[model samples]
Structure formats: structure tokens, C-alpha cells
Target: MASNTSLSSLSILIALLFLTNCQAARHLLEETPEVESPPHPTIPTLPKPELPPVPEEPTIPKVELPPLPVEPTVPKVELPPLPEIPKVELPPKPSIPSIPKVELPPVPSIPKVELPPKP
Candidate 1:
């Protein structure tokens, strides 16, 4: 890649030399005047080119499109009447018995437990 870049630069230098030589040759030699000027020749007058006046920009027209038709709606459906459920009459719950109040006996006192001496 580096070699290719250097080669291109060398070729450009050669082309520039050719261009400079051609310019130098034209400067070194001048052709004799075909006719002597009377101090100065009458300057030629040229008519300026006539360009057409720019046309006015056109205006954009707006087009109105009709609104799209509405879609058909499906009627709401009602389910068939639910089958009449038989009245479920559960038997009345048995009445709870009233408990009689009773007094309990006091807990007995335990004698002091003693540990025997180890030999």
C-alpha cells in the first residue's frame, strides 16, 4: 500500500513537469503582430443576451376525498332464559344445648422432691 502511494506521487510530478514545459515554451516565443493597432482598435460592442423573465410559481390545489362508509354493526345477542332452578330448602339446623355451670376441684399439692447424695 505504501509503495502504491509513492508511485502515484512520482507520476503526478512527471505530469506537472510536462505542463510547466508547455507554458514556458509559449512565454519564451511571441508571434509577430498580424496588424498594427491604431494605438487602439475600436472596441467591439456585443448585445447582452436576453433572458426570459422568470415565470410566477404555480399554486398547489387541494382535493377533498369523501369519508369512508361506516362498517355494519352486529346486533347484541341475549342468551336463552336460564332453566328455572328448583328452590333448595335445607332442613333447619338442630338447636344447640345450653351447658350447666359446674365448679372444679382444686389441684393437689405435691410433696418436695429431694435428690439423694452421690457416692
Candidate 2:
């Protein structure tokens, strides 16, 4: 019961605070007059400074090179012929035996069951 009363008092205090804030806001909105703001000041423009021109690059001289020497030719040597190899005969592979087939018995069927009617 004490907690309930404290909760109720807290809720009432919050409601009163909200109502007072709303009333103050309504008074400010209705009573205050609109005023014009002062214009912004303009800044003066500054002149740009002049710069000196760049100097030209110096020219380079060309150089000449001596000619290369010629290469000498070489003669190829001849080789003797190789001996011929004899032919060889190979044996034939044996055939694999066939496997016999296996037979299995059939599975038995399950019997059906009936339940009694509900009361």
C-alpha cells in the first residue's frame, strides 16, 4: 500500500511537471514577436602576386662508335652408322574363370492386428 501511494505521487508530480513545461512553451510561442537579423559583413578581395619565368635546358652533344670484327666459319665432322636390333616374340595371357551365382530365400510377411471399438 505504501509503494502504491509513492508510485501514485511520483506519477502526479511527473504529470504536473509536463503540464507546466507545455504551458511555458505555449506562452513563449504566442507572446514572442519575430525580429529581423543583421546582415553579414563582406570581405575585401586580395590581388595575386607575379612569378618569374623558368630558364631553358642546355643541349647535349652526340658521340660516334667503332665498327665490330667479322666471325670465322667452322667445318662439321661425319659419324659411322649404328648396328640393327633383332626382333623378340612374347607369350599370350591366360583367361580368368567365371564366378557362380548365389541364390537367397524370400522374407516372411507380417500378420495384421485389429483393435477393439472405443466405449
Candidate 3:
């Protein structure tokens, strides 16, 4: 059929394209040369600067002060006592009723038919 021939021709064209791509990749890998990378430059080290020493603090003379006077004591005020509250009683909760169980009928069995033997 014409459809079968067209399909075969399409498959052959795809196969040729794949083969050409593979051949080009192989040729590029074989012909390309490896390049060397440049070396990194070295950095110079700098010397640290020295600082001058700090001067010592000057000595100060101490002076004596007079003692403070004693403070007077304060009297505390008495407060009245609070009255007691009365206790309250609550009623008991009601009970829930029980449900009865239900009974189901038995299922019937199906009958089987026997077939004749083939000749």
C-alpha cells in the first residue's frame, strides 16, 4: 500500500538524520584540541602599624562626710473582717433509655444447572 511505503520512507529519513548528527558529533570530538588555562597572580603581604602606649590615671584625695539622722517609725491602721457566703446545692442528671436488638430473615440458596457433554 502507498501508506506503508510512505511510512517506511519517513522512518528511513529519520534514521539517516540521526546517523548524520552522530557522525558530526564524532568528528567534532576527534578534531577539537584541548586548551591550557592561565595561572593565577600572587598577592603581596602588608606590615602592621605599631600604636603608642596609654598614659596612667592621676591619684585623687578622699574627704570625710558627716553621718545622717535616724528616721521616725509609722503606725499601721487595722481593717474590719469580711462576712461569709452561703453554699448552694444542685439537682442530679437524668438517665438515658436502652434500645432493643432487631432480628433478620435467612437468605435462600440458588439452584445450579448441569450442561450436556460435547461430541
> For every model shown, what is its TM-score relative to the native structure?
0.28, 0.40, 0.36
Please give, for residues 11-67, the per-residue lDDT of candidate 1 as tens digits: 999999999999888776655345655776679999999999999999999899999
Residues 1-119, candidate 2: write the lDDT tens digits. 47988999999999999999999999999999988899988888888888788888887776667677677767776778878887777788788888887877888888988899999
Off by over 4 Å in 2: 57-119
lDDT of 1 at 90: 100
lDDT by residue for model 3 over 16-82, one digit each (tens)?
Answer: 9999999999999999998777998888888988878888889887877888877787878788887
- Identify the candidate with maximal lDDT: 1
Model with the higher TM-score, candidate 1 or 3: 3
- Where model 1 places Cα greater than 4 Å from the true spot, the runs are 1-69, 104-119
Q: How many backbone clashes does candidate 2 have?
A: 0
lDDT for model 1, please.
0.89
Q: lDDT of all the models against the reference?
A: 0.89, 0.87, 0.87
RMSD of 1: 30.8
Better of 1 and 3 by lDDT: 1
**Residue pairs in collision within model 2:** none
Give every collision pair in model 1.
none
